[model samples]
Target chain A: MAKTPIAFSLNGMERSMFVDPGQNLLDALRRGVGDLSPKYGCAQGTCGTCSVLVDGKLQLACITLAEAVAGSSVTTTAGLADGSELHPLQRSFMDNFAAQCGYCTPGMLMAAKALLDRNPSPQRQDVVEAISGNLCRCTGYEPIIDAILKAAAFMRTRGRP
Target chain B: MALHRGRGFACVNYPIGMNLGGDPSQALVHSTPDGKFMVTLSSIDLGQGMKSVTRQIAAETLGVPVSDVYVDTADSDTGPHCMGSFASRGTHRVGNAVIRAATEARTQMLQAAAEELEVDAADLETDGEGGIRVRGAPQRTISVADVAVAAQFKQGRTLSGRGIFLVPPSEVDPETGEMSPVTCFAHAAMAVEVEVDDETGMVRVIEINSAYEVGRALNPKLVEQQLVGGAWMGLSHALYETTEPYYPDRDHLPVDFNTYLMPGPGDVAPHNIAVLERPAEDAPFGGKGPGEMCANPVLPAVANAVFDAVGVRCDDLPITPEKILRGLRANGS
Candidate 1:
């Protein structure tokens, strides 16, 4: 298959890469740009492991065409943390042990970020509805919810509106 | 303690000629002969973090550092035979065997350390770093790693320990379908509430309360993860996971990320989750398996919850809107 030149900003860096016709954004990112945050849990997008932000909207990269997001900014999990410093959600996730095996963390984090970006002070119900699709087989939602709420508190104190 | 599988009495203590039903998990541990070390099961980590917990159990028993207690899956070619990890029985059955094996290893290390440090073997306490010493005597210490290197692998001493625990075949008459040796039992319970759309018949699990008897919580955090994971799986089974349309034509089935109908941020219950853990006596860590326990109740739970809200008892794995609507239509609701 002939490769198509797709331009996009991954994480924070503006970059362009040649992608195969059959390649999804996930494969293109993980295989091409060397970003390993968004994992391939269920390639069918149901598992939410390959979620990324395309133009600031959460999208499943595994099924998404690389061409769809041409010239769009893509944000992956790796870009969330500032070097060794974790984002509030990531910190809360670790503190609450919301992630285990961590295969699903990337997608879950992205989804939650999208939710918070939309409604930073979402109620518990809103939080549930926001992350309903991301399946985590390890921590029952109790901790994840707790972590999210805690992150919200921290984010508020830090003036992350 | 030998790690066994299934619901007691039928635990197979020996490995099979062929992989059983294509279970990808395995047990891992190294043991020595003289009934000193025991390798109970393979190191098949089910994302429960029991692998590290198994090492903890082994190290604590052997008086070695958690790191010194290296674990590996038994080789079908020439290793001790036992059922590999799966069915969430690692800590229950395998942890015991690992304890037994490590205890033997510990004893030898202690005896050697005692003799070298001029202290009673009982006077020494094992450390997580695989070292042992008298309570107040820092200088009087011996490392289990050094002992293992000198005593087993290097000296060619048979570091062989064996654990074979099979679920006892039910003593009940086979003709009557009764069986025994009922090695152990694990129980779980779940309570869920779902909101059903009267128009759409869509059932959304609104709240879930769950409790399980885990022989023990080897890794408290890890087990919690299992509970969360199980709940999600249950949720998936209740609403989205189905093997229908693309069944006969496997290729047509939901493939890749886009086509499948899976619960997402927009699909989960908003509030209420209660998780309780009950310890088990027979389990090596007093934790029972929580992995599948949460899932088993999910289908029935959501269905029952939906029924509570909309008055329907769905008799299907996934109580999809179609099934609920059908149940409603059959009942003329």
Candidate 2:
């Protein structure tokens, strides 16, 4: 397979990579770009562990084509934290014990980020619907829901510091 | 067709560890020159917080702050032996071994501190705040860091200890056919409420109320997470997941999360939990691992709830709608 050149802004940094034609964004980012935050849990995209953001929209990296993401800004769990300080979602997750095993955390965090970016104040049901695509075998989805709501409140008040 | 609601209850007494031949786990605890402690083990966490629970156990036994200890789950080549984490044995078996190793290391630390203070080793006590002091005199104290520094540089002593725990196989009486395989047991009682639709034969779990007796909760947060997640898995097993959908046929097996049915976030019901602590005699800090048993009671409770609602027995797992419809049609409802 001949490699196709695709360029995109990843986590606020411009990077270029050569990926095999029809290669999914997950494999391209993990193998070609070396950003390992997005995990490959289910390659079929049923499990949202490979969730990432393409131009600030929730996209499943496993099912998405790397070529389609050309010239688009892609955000992942790796981009959530700013240096040593954590994002509000990450802090809320840590405080609320929202992660176990942590295989689904990157996806959950990405999904939550997508939700908070659009709806700054999400209700419990809204939070449920937002991350409904993501599957977590641990935490029972209770604490994750709580963490998302908590982060929404913190982000509304603190304004993303 | 109308929806019928019903409630059912069930209880379980789950054994702590596997009854296999000498289920054993080993641990190694060592202190760095900077006073930070490292606990090495071969047991895997597997999302059950085995590493966190064992770190807490080691820190408590060593009389040091929990942050001062780091748990390293090393490979078999580097770490001590452990009968891999399963059957809820990580907390109990691995915890006891960590306590033993940390205790030994603590003793050595106290001896080195005593040598520095020119006092008897028996007279020294760890302050649980990174300091070693004389039991009676508070003024006579030395930091654990200073003690470790002196022990390594001057005394040329290595502050390390190794431990292993094994529960020998229980002897079975040939005539009576009885044996005590497990030393302790964790218990649970659950009541589940469900609504069954006679039209579609769909079962919706309204809520779950349950109590667990996990001997003791070493880390309540970890225990709570396990209980909560385990119950969801139980619910998934009871009403949703099945490897064989067409029964007795090798075809039509689910290969991914979409084809394989499981409870989504929307399908989660309200769960009310009450954890009881009746410290076990032989458990480490009187704590049993609440890893596997949290899901046992839900399976039978859900089945019983469906039986109460539609008066049909679902002996097989998942209690699929097709099975329920067949049962309802057979009853001529």
Candidate 3:
């Protein structure tokens, strides 16, 4: 298979790389782009560990073809932090002890970011529904749900994204 | 259509560290020139907070701030030997070794500080804030950083300690077939409530109340997280997850998470936890460890809850709806 050039904006920066035709976006991001935050877990897309934001939409990088989403803006958990300051979601997750092993954190953060971006104030059920695709083997989802709700409140009070 | 609600309870006792082949964990604690300390061990974290807990243990033993201690659990090639992390033994086994090593290092640090101050080593006491002061005079203090510099450059004393924790092997009595396999045991009890739909044969867990005697919770939050995650794993094993649908015949094997069923956030029930402290005599900081014990009582509790709700004993795992429906038909309900 011949390698094709795919250009996209990642974390507010434009990046271009030659990717294998059959390679998924996850491999393109991790190997080509050197973005290790979006982990390669259950590459079949069941674990939701490879979740990323493509053009403001929640997409699984493992199943998404590299060339299919060319020129799209991709956001990962690494993009959640602004320099030294962490995002409200990340802060709330640490404060509430949401993550245990930290393996499922990137996906959970992406899923929560997608929800909060759409609805600034979401109900508990809505939060649950948003991260339903992501599986966390630690913290039992209670702390994760609590952290998302608390992050929503924090973001609402700050009146900023 | 009638829905039956039922409750069930189960208890379990799990040993902290197995003594098979002499369970051993080794740790090396050394001080840097900047007063910071590093503990190197081969025990893997496995997301159970082994690094954090061992750092805490070492800091407490060394009479320093927890942040001053850095635990390196990188790889077995560089660090000292450990029996690996499993059987809920990291905290108990590795922590004990860390305490021993940190204690020896602390003694060496105190001696160096005493030499720097020209005072008796026994007259010096650590302030737990990286300061070594005279026992009676709080103002007469020397910073640990200054002591470290003097110990290495002036006194030529290397402030380092090594420790290895091993449970003595107990011989089994040939006639009685009795032997203590581990140093300490952690205990847990769980009560589960479930709702069963007679027509659909679907079982849903409503609530769970669990109590665990973890000996000591080094980090209470970590302990609770382990328990909650473990209980969810139990619920998944009891009602949802199954690797072998037709045993002895490898057909329809699940290759993905969608095919291999696991509990999601929606399947999670309300869990109330009560942590009891029953300190172990020989364990580190009296912590017998509670990692693996969290999932032990959940399986039997959920199984018994299903039996109570539908009056059917599911001897097999993953008491699926199909299994419950067959049990209901057999009971002629």
List the global CA lDDT of all models. Answer: 0.66, 0.92, 0.90
Worst 10 contiguous positions by lDDT, candidate 1 chain A: A136-145
TM-score of each: 0.72, 0.98, 0.97
Across residues B287-322, which tens digit of lDDT does each residue of candidate 3 receive? 877878788788889889988988989988888888
Candidate 1's C-alpha runs over 4 A off are: A1-24, A41-47, A53-60, A63-75, A79-87, A113-142, A155-161, B1-43, B64-85, B115-122, B127-131, B135-139, B142-177, B245-260, B270-281, B302-311
Using alpha carbons, what is the TM-score of model 1?
Answer: 0.72
Question: What's model 2's overall lDDT?
Answer: 0.92
Candidate 3: what is its chain A TM-score?
0.98
Query: Tens digit of lDDT per residue, candidate 2, span B1-333?
Result: 999998989999999887677789999999998989999998998889998999889988898899999999948889999989888888899999998999899999999998999999999888888999999999999999999999999999978888888897887899999988887899999999999999999999999999999988988988888898999999999998989987798698887787899888899999999999999988999999786888889999999999999998889988989889999998889
Q: Which candidate should be chosen as best, given lDDT against the real structure?
A: 2
Clashing pairs in 3: none
Each prediction's DockQ against the real complex: 0.40, 0.81, 0.72
Residue-by-residue lDDT tens digits, candidate 1, A20-138: 88789899888988998889877876888899999889999999998787899999999998889889999999888777667778877888899888887879877787777687756
Between candidates 2 and 3, the one scoring higher on lDDT is 2
Q: Give chain B TM-scores in order.
A: 0.75, 0.98, 0.97
Indicate the residue-level lDDT of B197 in model 2.
96
Q: What is the i-RMS of every prediction?
A: 3.4, 0.7, 1.1
Could you list the CA RMSD of all candidates, in the order they appear? Answer: 8.3, 1.3, 1.4
